[model samples]
Structures are given as C-alpha cells and as structure tokens.
Target chain A: MFPFRVPGAAPIRPHGRAADEVGRLRRPFAVVVYLQSRDPAHVKAVERRTMDKPTHLIEFETMLLGRHLQLSAPRLRRNNQSLDRSAYTLLSRIRMEGPMSIGQLSEAFGLDASTLNRQTAAMLRAGLVERIPDPEGGIARKFRITEEGGRGLDAERSANISGLEKVMAAWEPEEVAAFAAYLKRLNTDIENLDGRPWPRP
Target chain B: MFPFRVPGAAPIRPHGRAADEVGRLRRPFAVVVYLQSRDPAHVKAVERRTMDKPTHLIEFETMLLGRHLQLSAPRLRRNNQSLDRSAYTLLSRIRMEGPMSIGQLSEAFGLDASTLNRQTAAMLRAGLVERIPDPEGGIARKFRITEEGGRGLDAERSANISGLEKVMAAWEPEEVAAFAAYLKRLNTDIENLDGRPWPRP
Candidate 1:
C-alpha cells in the first residue's frame, strides 16, 4: 500500500525454507534486532525458525494476513473503494445466499444477533439492504439486497481484486489460481467445522 | 464455534466448479432464500455464479478468511488460549523480530505511533512486553517480549493449530502443506508489495 523503503534493509529470504524447516527448530531462535534510527537505519528482524507443523504456519500467516487486510482497507479507500469490511462481507453473503433474516445471518456467520443487528442497521442506513417479508412466510423478517448493495458489492469486490492483482502481479496465473483455490478450500473447511458454511458463488 | 444446524439445510456442493467457471456469469445469479423456521424449515439459498476472474475469487475468499480468523479467537479462547488478539499479534511480531521501538513498529505495521503506543501500553499492563533500551543505541526505546508473552504466544498458536487441525481433519497432509505454503507465499507477496516484508525462518 505504501511505497515504504528502508535505505539499508536486507532482501527477503525466499519461502519453502520456513515450511521445509518444520521440526528443525525445537528450541526456536531468539531474535535480537539492532534497532537503529535516522541515518539509513534498518529495523533488522531475525528469521524465526519454529519447530511447528504446517498448520502452525498457516495459523500464523493468517493472523498476519488478517492484519494486512485490515490495514489494506484505508489504502484502497483512497482509490475509491466504498464498501467497509462489514458491508463487503454482508453484501457478499446476501449475494451468495439471497435474502436472510437476522437468525439465519447469525447462524450462517456464527455471529450473535446483536452484532448482526448493529451491522445490518448500518447497512440499512447505507441503503445496502432492505427489510423484506420473509419470502417463505417465516416469522423473522429477512434482509434482501437492494440494487445499491449489489452494485456496491460488485464495485468493492472488483476493487479488491484489482488490489490483489497488483499484490500478486509477479505471481504466475496458475499459482494465483492454485492459491485462490486453496484459500477457498481452507475457508470452506473452517465453515464446515463451524457449522456455518458460507455459500460459494 | 456453534454446531448449529437447521433442521433442513442443503448439502454442500463440491469445489472446482466455481474456479473453473470464471467469466461465465456477467450478471450474477440473484439468490432467493426459502427461509422457514420451526417445523423442518430450510434456509435455502440459491448458488451465485459470478463473472469474475480468479483474482476476484481470491479477494472474496480472503475477506471471508479475515472473518474466520477474527471469529476464531473466541473459539480458541475457550480452549485455554490466553492471549487476546492484540497481545498475540504483538507478541508474535516481537518474537519474530525481537525487540522493537514504537517508531519501528509503526513503520513495519503501517500503523500510527498513537496506535502503537496504546498497544504497547496495553502489553505493558498485561505483562506481555516491557520497554527496553535500544540495543543499537537508537534514541527510541524498544519493547521486548516478556517470558509470559512468549509462553502465551506459543500456547495460543498451538491452540490455533489444533483448531485448524480439527477444521481440516479430513484433508491429506500434502494438501495441508500446500495450503500453508500458498498462504505464506500470498502473505509474503503482500508484504513485499507493501514494502514491509515479514521475516521468515
């Protein structure tokens, strides 16, 4: 997002090293950075070698990825990305699953009703979703996507893709597709375990 | 997470089809839910078919992944995972990079100094990290992970992996490794593009 550069930073080590070094570091290395400042200072970080399983690596990477995506929103916002995180998520959900009541949303997302209420309230204010009588004649009122929501979702999703494209600019198309497929599988599996499966497009 | 089941939810479709169907739907399908409650009510939703590239799919999946990770903290917390989100994140970063000043953390994370200060203050209060003099004689003081912080990060990370293991219990080991590798690659690419490359083992 930012074209930040440390004047004297070391090149990044290639991958496969960490993944390949699984079970290689029973007593993980303790990093001691030589934090410097001003005149071409490099915030040196040690290469962490963990005696962790591949799943551990996945967990750690996802944690960092979550942070990246959170920080990524403001960067994209300047590029005219309108949808906030919740809106993108809810709109995407509604797009995939059609109309949903608070109960169904709660069940699908594993989120409490109050949280969904707050999110949907904001979405309502934004005109992203409209209250509709449950099409199947259920007691709980359902939320259906308005044209604005769909349009906003489409735009925001497109912007996100554009941003990702830039991030993955150097990656092979096959690699990109494979990574995307893996992520989808990973999430679907998590959803399955949570009993809150997100509908796929 | 909740093992929530609607009395009548539809079966999941196998993957590969969506990834293969790129650019197939210019105007995505409009989902219609058959939301019913009580007596075997099915929250039936139509499948969405988007005219998007593979990059778009990645974007959508990653957004969902962010949600999964956020929601995952609570599930893991119940399993004796003690570190809160910020604590776990900060400790992990500290562990990986060793000690870091607020200025260094701000530069690496793209977060403001105020946010870093607040996070460090919380870490200090929680006994997770401590302020230490800059090793390289830099002006700004750095925060180092405490023994408690390291121990907590390890435990929390272990729990996270265990949770992921349960989530991916059915997948083969090779698949797990490939997913992890892809995830690392994706994050590194993001970090590289953002000019804040995370140090790997």
Candidate 2:
C-alpha cells in the first residue's frame, strides 16, 4: 500500500467516458486515496522507493539545502554584521579576485546586471565595497572590497566553518574531499546551465 | 597565490611585540600577504593544501550550499504558489506524515514554536493546510494537507527535481547515489548537532 497518492498517477481514460465526467469522478477519488493511507510501514516503504530515484534524491538535496539555510541564517551573522548570504558571497568573491566591474561580477555569479547593481549599491552604502577605477583601465569602474568588509566576511566565514567542522568532525578526510568535489561539480553545472559559468581561479 | 585568502592563516604570535602593535601591524600585513600572491601555480598549490584539510572542505561546502540556495530560491516557486522554501518544506512534511501538531513540527524542524506558528498560519490562510482534530485523540490539534497543497507541492517538487536532474544528467547513477547518501549523512549530522533529529520515515 502506498502511503501517499502519487499526484496525477492515474491516467484519465476518456474511452467512451465524458472528459468532464472523468475529471469530476477522479478528483474525489484521488483525494480519498491520498488521505486514507496513513500506515507508517507503507510510508516508510514509499519513502525508500522515492529516495532511490535520482530525481527524488535531487529534490531532497535541494530541500535539505534550503532548509539548512533557513535554519542557519540567523546564526551565520557575526559581530553585528547583518550581511545576508548574497552579500557575504559577493564580498568573499570580490575579496578573492580583487576589484571587479559589476558586469564581471554579474557574469561570474550568473546573476543579472540589475540584481548586482542593487546588491553592490547596498554593499557600497554599508561600506563593504567601494567603487574604484578599474585596475585594467576599463570603461566601467570596479568594486573593491573594503577592510571592514573583509573583517566581516572573515568573521562570518570562520563562524560558519567552525559550525560545519563540528558537524563533520566524525567524517573521514576522504569523505569530505569527495563531497566537496561533487558539490563543486554540481555548482559548476548549475552555473553552466545559467550560462554564466565562473572562470576557474 | 591563493584563489581565495584562507582567512585566519596567520599564526597568533604574542611572543615579543606589544599586543596592540601586533594587532595593528598584522592587519595590513595579512591583507597584503593575502592579496599580493596571485601566481596561478601558487594558487593551485594553496587550493590543494586547503582541500586536504577537512575544516576547509567543510567550510567550502557550507559556502557552496548557501550560495546555491540564494541563487535558486527565486526559481523554486511554481506559478503564484508564493511559498518560500520553508513553507514548501512544511507543506511537504504535512502531506507526507499526515496531520501533525505545531509543536511536533517545531521539534522535527529544530525551529522554535513561534516560527512554526507563523509559517503554519500563513499556510493555513493560503489553504495549503487545515487545522484538524488529532487522529490519535491528543489535546493538540494537528495540521492536515489540503488537496491544493499536495498539488502545489508536487508542482514545485517536480520543477526542482527537473532542475537537479539536468545538473546531474552527465553523472553516473552511482555518483548520484553516493552524493545523495553523503548529503543525507551531512544533514543528519547537522540535525543531531541541534538535538532535534527528524524521525526517519
């Protein structure tokens, strides 16, 4: 017995049956089938089957990552630095790559120019980054990480690292390496899909 | 030359200098040291060294996960479902586990009661879930997923899974399974750290 009715699992057979009648009849049946099954063993078996599917595994990973972000966002800030995840990431990127134009940052992050403009403008107001002449003498100015921004980024990064370290302390080094490689490959694929692949540093 | 400055790489030496002077002097030195090294070969070496350390690997994974969520949140919604990541997750949980109380959800999610209340209330107003008498005849009422909720959850889940599948398409089945297992383990460890492990289905 399936624990939950798989949505749209039933084919609507219109053979000698009115389409409207099929729709009307199947709706209540679907709901009933979905609500009636509450057996734990069935749920477990269904969950196990779902977990075995690659698509389900991917969905579960996405959901887990989103949940972890929501759960940890509040605790991620350090020393009154209210940098959201995006801000923290932007600062870290700028700090590592030195000054970069908004276009460059946009391309690197796979975000649009308008989004980067708003984010960088906010960062500028917060003194996280400063607009400066492009080091390569380009037409557009570049944004450079400020000292305060570096400190905030470092503090937050360290705090997050410490938290992750504690969580992963039991894992072997090889396990960590394999996970990281997979994650990097995943992100790279995501970036490629968005057509804004970040260049290898 | 490091692709990123390994934050907190400087050894804390309080041997002979005034602590304040050392603090003031080391600040610039650290920044300069971090920025001036731009040799690609050196960067690769440093990256390899960093990857070998489990703490750094964990930090990289955390940062990548955070970045991925920030990037994907906008695309995860379906039509006007308008459910944030947390709401979608909550609805999915209810749909899977049948009716559950706010307290139970809070405990399972490792979130506070007030947060779950606000989330569930929004879900209730949105008709994604309804308050129901506990099936087990407990004092606390439970939340049940509405038919509409299940539909929305299915839509969003399918969209996310499609995206993930595209990302993982080139990966072997075994690779996907290994990555999924690792991710599950990591999430389990994180939940355990918070002392609110979700019961396995």
Candidate 3:
C-alpha cells in the first residue's frame, strides 16, 4: 500500500574513492530497502560482509548518523525528551522485575554506576521511584518504582501502543503475530548480547 | 536473508487495548519496528499523521526516540531526522537555492522566521552553513551551506538511501520504484508548499 517515489533532488555524487569507501558503511535503511528490493540472496551477501566488519556499523552509526541525530540534544533536553524515556525504562523494568538494587540496574543496562545513580537520582526527585535503606547496609540503596511512576508508565504505554495497533489494522493476524514475535526476539537478542537478564513480567 | 527464528522467551502478553494505544507514541525501538513493518502507503500515513499533529510528533520524538538516539541540539542543528523526510526539503533548498536571508529561509520553510533564525544560528556555529554579508546592507544576513555542511548532508543521504536499499532488497523492482516515486512527490509537495522554487541541479 506504500506509494513510493523517487527523491526529486540530485543524488549526492560520490566525489572519489574515499566517498565510495565511506558510502559502503552499513546503514539500517540499507537493510530495510534490500528486504523490499526482494533480493534476499544479495542481502545475505551484504549481511555477511556487515558481519565481517562490525566496525563499519559502529563507525557509520557513531561517526555519522549518530552525530547528526545527536545535534538536537540540548534543545530536546530542555523539552520532555530527556525526562520521559529513562523514566519509562526504569519504571518498566521495575514493574516487570520487582525492586532492583542500584548496582543491579546499572549492570542490567551496562551503564556506569555513576550514570545510573544520576538517572535514578532524577527518578527519586520526581517521586516516580523511591530509594530505600538497604537492610544489608552495604552502602547500596534499593530502588522501587512508585505509584506515580506506574501511573506515568501506564499512560505512556497506552498512548504508544494504541497508535501502533491502529496502524497495523490492515495487517493479517498472522502477520502481526509474526512481526511481534520477531520484535520480541530481536529485543531479547540485543539484550542478551549486552548481558542483561530478561525481564520477568 | 533475515534468518527467521522463533523467540525463546515467553509469549509477550498482549497488553490489550492499553498496549496498542501506548505504542502509538513512537519510541525508537517501537518506531523502528512500526515503520519497518509498514508499506510505503502506511509510511505516508504515519508521516502525514505525524505532521498533522506537529506538536505531538515533536513531543513524541523529542521525548521518546530522539533522546536514545542521543542526538545533540548542535548535531540536530546540522541535520534532523531523515525519517521525517520532509525535513530534507529545507536542506535541499539551502543547498540548491540558498545564499538566502533568514527571512527567506523562514519563508521557504513556512516556519516562524525567529525559529528559522535560531536553527540557522546553530548551523552557523557548526560551520555546516555560513552567514554572508547581505549585499543590500539590511540587518539580516544571507546564509549558504558550507562545504563541510554539504559533505555532512551527502553522508546522511548516502546512509539513508543505502540503508533503505538494503532493507528492501527482498522486494521487487516495481515495488521499490513505486515507493521511490511517492517519496519524490512528498518531498516536492513539501518544497512547493514551503515556498522554495524547485532546484534545477
């Protein structure tokens, strides 16, 4: 049902060999487009190349796309973007997996302890999460999602999921099920590689 | 070939209406999944819906997907999401037809001149663009894309186009051509409405 169009502007001309080499960097769009192009074998070849050079994916994402996407950070932070996602992720984890130690949360996300502390500090400030004295008293505090956090997470979840379902109304039940299954696996695979335990909801 | 595999994890308990509603909010992973699943027609709908609810899209993106993307304001000042697609129109105009004043840029984008001025100010600092002396000696300055900016733009274009090319490799050529055509129309429509003359080059 998608109506495709050619981009009207002039294609960026590759200036030389450097451009050609740099242009081959892995992009998420390339994966999607190749799937649409219906050349799974070519995609398999490209995927093999991508797997062989993990650094290209890292470099392309970090050096280029990451740079451009991130340029908006300061302006975005002053708005709600900074506040919501972390808050939601923290709360989601808490809701799904009971109370967690600050260290546990830190390890789960592979974030520095200090960064986790700082992030949780905000949650504590908002009363979206609470810091409790550890009975073990080992210099670590236990954190739990609060009712406020639950309420906020619920609202956010409701809004986001509703939109997706409406958009997917045209899809067959089997298609939706398949996509959802893939999504969960992808999420799990990503987390597993990062060494995070699966959430137990 | 996407090696389709069944998830080892438990079936994701459908959150019923609540989860679907919440999915509409456009978090990064969710957006990737949602947008990726969509056909070009569906994408146009999503983009239209996103633009129609500009405040929502801005809030949704700013709060949800934008942060994890970890994009900085300065970085975004250089480039916004290609996912938005329409954003490319302004950049395209600047590259093809600029050396235009802030007022002109604002007029072309149909945004508040002050907002466009703010955007250009960041571009100026990043040296992605520059402000030249207005030959007419007005208080306003004329802006043009810098060489570095052009390089950055080209890099992003290559990333996105190449990325899509890979993703849809499994689709037929006609399917690929169709979506490309729609994208071209959408880009042109935005530029035409936004007040920039189409660039010959």
Task: Highest DockQ: give the candidate number.
Answer: 1
lDDT of 1 by residue, A111-171 (tens): 8999999999999999999999999999989999999998898888777878887777777
- Give residue B78's lDDT in candidate 3 (0 to 100): 33
TM-score of chain A considered alone, across all candidate predictions: 0.71, 0.65, 0.58
What ordering of candidates by TM-score runs from best to worst? Answer: 1, 2, 3
lDDT tens readout by residue for model 2, A12-76? 22223333433332334343432344565653443343333355775676577667765754543
* Candidate 1 Cα errors over 4 Å, as ranges: A1-53, A73-80, B1-53, B76-82, B135-137
- TM-score winner, 1 or 2: 1
Query: Across residues A22-57, which tens digit of lDDT does each residue of candidate 3 receive?
Result: 234434454334334435576556545432323222
**Candidate 1: tens digits of C-alpha lDDT, residues B1-201:** 112323564423223334223222222221112112212223122222222336877887899888887774556335754666767877888898999998888888888999889988988998889899999999989999999888778888878877887777777655767878888887887777778877776
**Residue-wise lDDT of candidate 2 within B1-201, one digit each (tens)?**
322334656422222333233233223434334334556565445434433335665566567666766665345334544456777888877777789998889777877899889989998998889999999999999999999888878887776776677667788656887888888898788777766655444
Off by over 4 Å in 2: A1-53, A73-82, A100-107, A110-118, A133-142, A199-201, B1-52, B73-83, B133-142
- As a TM-score, model 2 comes out at 0.66
Candidate 3 residues lying further than 4 Å off, grouped into runs, are A1-83, A135-137, A197-200, B1-68, B71-123, B132-144, B152-201
Docking class of 1: acceptable
Query: Worst lDDT window (10 residues) for model 2 chain B?
Result: B11-20
